[model samples]
Target: MTAEDPTHPDLLQRWNATLLAARAGREGPDPAPYGHNLLARWAEPQRAYHTVDHLRAVLDRVDELVDQGGEGGELELVRLAAWFHDAVYRPDRSENEERSAALAEKALTEAGLTGHEVREVARLVRLTVTHDPAPGDLNGETLCDADLAILATDPDTYRGYAEAVRTEYAFVPDEAFREGRAAVLRQLLSLPRLFRTPYGAAAWEERARENLERELRELTGAS
Candidate 1:
């Protein structure tokens, strides 16, 4: 977890393996043509939001949720959703959900996945946008919460993530970036809890709120 610590090879391998297996296990069938096309593009480095490292971070966060006892029986769907959630990320578009879902549909279908399975993954991926789910829908809530877990990270780390996101949109003016980023931090502070899972909410909620408060104060020169 420390900055100096290297990326763990085992963890990376396991995630890649999981994605491949889950894709291969479906009932309907893999769109081999599209599959070949998508896989080639998936590994290429991108400047904006779809960075490989960001995808890895999301998977790590999702695993953290599972370790903390996220809802059972929906584990694969959550993990698959996490992988595909930002696969087709384009910073300028408001239709990230549909794009990501399209990528998911292509992959799931090629893997012989059925309509119901593809729909489940697509729904979970789309859930990242709404974020708010019924109290009982632990799976959806956990994945969505993990996506925002950066709010609960240490201030310096949170700041780094903020910069990364901004850099992804380097075309934006400095003033615009500052205003937009500050607003996002404020929204997180306004939330009841940044994390929806019981343990994440209980253990990290207070720190996340504090981090957001500090960011807001620094932005407005109030503290």
Candidate 2:
């Protein structure tokens, strides 16, 4: 893998191309055209979470699954879902996935997909609402776990994720913010499992547990 060899198939380049082409032509919607209009609106420079980097991370994971030859037709569906999962992200909104799904639905329609295809894409996007992947949907489960891959990263990477999340909520007061955030992390750790994929489960489970335990210790000053 040389400097220009290009690794990882994160639709980031394709997405940037879409944006660029649209801008160059000045004849269509923004770079990434969603089927729905007027989704959640985040302030400029989404800053930390929900940024292109996070989207790319999720996309990379989806691509990994696809290359590993899993998910079937749901592969592209989940990949597209990853792209638009955070499309309508707003720090102030609770129904982020609902709004993001709207955008994905619109994009699928505009892409000349059938109504069923559009709906499937929308459903995939909705899976990120609470990161609960259904047992029956292997692809959906993969994407959901990928979206939360951050939680299972090594301690140093996980710590960076925690900082990014905290930065996202800079508006909240320190005490309440720490309380709320700690509770959220703890609850996530309480889940019977973190990453749903067999490979991810084997590799990241212990590290995620360690990360969670470390965070909890920091929160209460007791290990």
Candidate 3:
């Protein structure tokens, strides 16, 4: 959704709360401007899957993990990571994650977060490049699981997500897109565990695998 949309206000509020909590009473400039900047980034015209809706979904999934007793380290930091994770997405570019992480480093540092907090947030944002967080990395697991929770959605919803991703890469020819997308699916399927958090594994593992396999088969025309 665009910054002009109704949801913008609520998202800005969420951002404000998360930023304030992360700041821990440290003095900083008004957060509303930073929130606005991020919201506008998420609403960029080139995005289809990585839009404001995706941002909200990731944030919600992070909350779900915590509420369900999963190990979610430093909630406010995790939330900030979620916000910056895809804030600089471009389907055509491979450096999006690195750039997003850098943005988080700069923005969060300026927003009054301590060096440790900013580094953690940037590290979490970069981990999206490979959802496979090392074992026992609670914060990494939480953010990665939440970002990929989309894969465990109901069949129709999963299909819609795939379509949205395709829409983002519309510049790619269909055959090439299918090949690249199938490779991604295969890579994910090859992972020993798609959901690193215990709650995510218990609640979403099977469904996410089924969805990925189904989509892979469709993409490859496999029996």
Candidate with maximal lDDT: 3
In the range 1-223, model 1's lDDT, one tens digit per residue, is 3436444444455545665566565444333444344433444544444565566677788888788877664676777787778767666677988888888887776666567778888888887766666677767887787777776888888778766777777877877867876887766666666777887787778887887777777767785
Candidate 2 Cα outliers beyond 4 Å, as residue runs = 1-43, 68-73
Best by TM-score: 3
TM-score for each prediction?
0.80, 0.78, 0.97
How many clashes in each candidate?
A: 7, 6, 0
* Model 3's TM-score against the true structure: 0.97
Model 1 alpha-carbon drift over 4 Å, by segment: 1-16, 19-50
Candidate 2 per-residue lDDT over residues 1-223, each given as its tens digit: 2335333233435554533442344344443423212122321355577665677688677767556655455565666677777777667668988988987777656655557766887898887766666666787778887788787787788889988887888888888887987887777787788777776677667887888888878877784
RMSD after CA superposition, every candidate: 4.2, 6.2, 1.5
Order of quality (TM-score): 3, 1, 2
Better of 1 and 2 by TM-score: 1
Which model, 1 or 3, shows the larger lDDT? 3
Q: What is the lDDT, from 0 to 100, of the residue 154 in candidate 1?
A: 85
In model 2, how many backbone clashes occur?
A: 6
The reply for model 3, stretches above 4 Å from the true place, is 1-7
lDDT: worst 10-residue window of model 2: 35-44
